[model samples]
Target: MTLILAHRGYSAEYPENTMLAFREAAKAGADGLELDVQMTKDGELVVIHDEKVDRTTDGTGFVKDYQLKDLLKLDARFKFASLPNREPIPLLKEVLEWLAGTDLICNIELKNTLFMYEGMEEKVIEMVREFRLTDRIIISSFNHYSIVKSYMLAPEIEIAPLLSDGLYMPWIYAQSIRAKGFHPHWRAAQDEIVISSLDSGVEVRPYTVNKDNELERFFRVNCSAVITDDPVNARLIREKTKQA
Candidate 1:
């Protein structure tokens, strides 16, 4: 079956990258959940989508500048301009614990900037091992060192390289890092690129592909998965496509 990975846990319905959101996505029958992680000032792995907390939380500061205690104090709201009571930022451990027995797979995207977290890669892998979720998790990152170090730390865990702007020949980079998959932007999902990744035997799952035509193109080329904001609509599309 074509995999329907929920982007930030059905972000269209709830706050992105929250435990509540992930739980809802699993309940909605999403095959997988994609989440982003960044290290707090105290060197703890926290689930969040942005580099700064100002956009999603009531607090105003870079995540790396605040300790985990401070981050927990802030309200991780949805639609910051509208509903400020949605949810709070969830720790990566919280997610691993919640997904212990569930069938949902995880795609962990590490948000590493220049400031660098001390042993961040090892810390994430240790959590995955403690939870015995190495096989169920796929680590990804825009930072090559983070993902590459993850591979060095735990070679058994699957890794995907997220390609966004101006990344031509991503398959070569993926191969260099021994990545199992390639996650490119929706606009970068060309047939040739898809075919090339397939030829290289790497899974090519594009992000935030919500358009009908884009979804159709994904299915037409048999891409590995589609990370989308609308799990309900994607699930319906998957079901109808199967019936067809």
Candidate 2:
């Protein structure tokens, strides 16, 4: 069966990357969670998508400029004004600690492609090791170099490259980087590509898959997983596909 991973933790209905979102995603029966991680000025790992806080939070500057304490002050609920309480940016440590108690898999996308957060991989790996959740964690990045560095630091944990555009024989490219999986944009995950890659032992899990037809397609095809903002809808579609 294809796994349903909540993209940014059931972000369709809740403020993304917030504890509320993750908890709700688990309650909705998602198999996993996909989230982004970036480093703060104080060298703390934070769970947010962008290099800057302008888009997601009430803050206006780069995430790298703020100390963890200062960063936590910005409400992550900027996009969802209807939400009542302030949603603070969560620390990687806090998320990992929470994840330790669950059976859900986590795909932690290192947000270092733009700013190159020095030592971010090491810090993330160390934290995962500390939490003893290495087996259930997957480190992914659009920066192939960052993915390679993470693989070197902890080969026991799975690592994958995030692709926005299609790559020729991505499984081969993944093998070159020693990546155990591939997370591609939905369009990049062609049927032949998915089948061939999985046959080659490279797991393929596409991102941001939300449409009912698309969700059912991935489920029927048996790709490793589908990362979507609406895991609840995705889970429902998966059941329908199974019944068919």
- Identify the leading candidate in terms of lDDT: 2
lDDT by residue (tens digit), candidate 1, 1-244: 5698999998888888888789889989899999999889888899998888888778898899888887898787647446545577999999999898798899999887655777888999999999999999999887877788889889999998888864677788788889988899989879888888889888898998998778877777778899999888888877766666
The C-alpha RMSD in Å for every predicted model, in order, reads 2.0, 0.8
What candidate 2 gets wrong by more than 4 Å, as runs, is none
lDDT of 2 by residue, 137-225 (tens): 99999898988988988999999999999999999999999998899999999899999999999999999899888888888889999
lDDT of each: 0.86, 0.93
User: How does candidate 2 fare on TM-score?
Assistant: 0.98
Q: Lowest summed lDDT over 10 consecutive residues: which window, candidate 1?
A: 77-86
- Model 1: clashing residue pairs? none
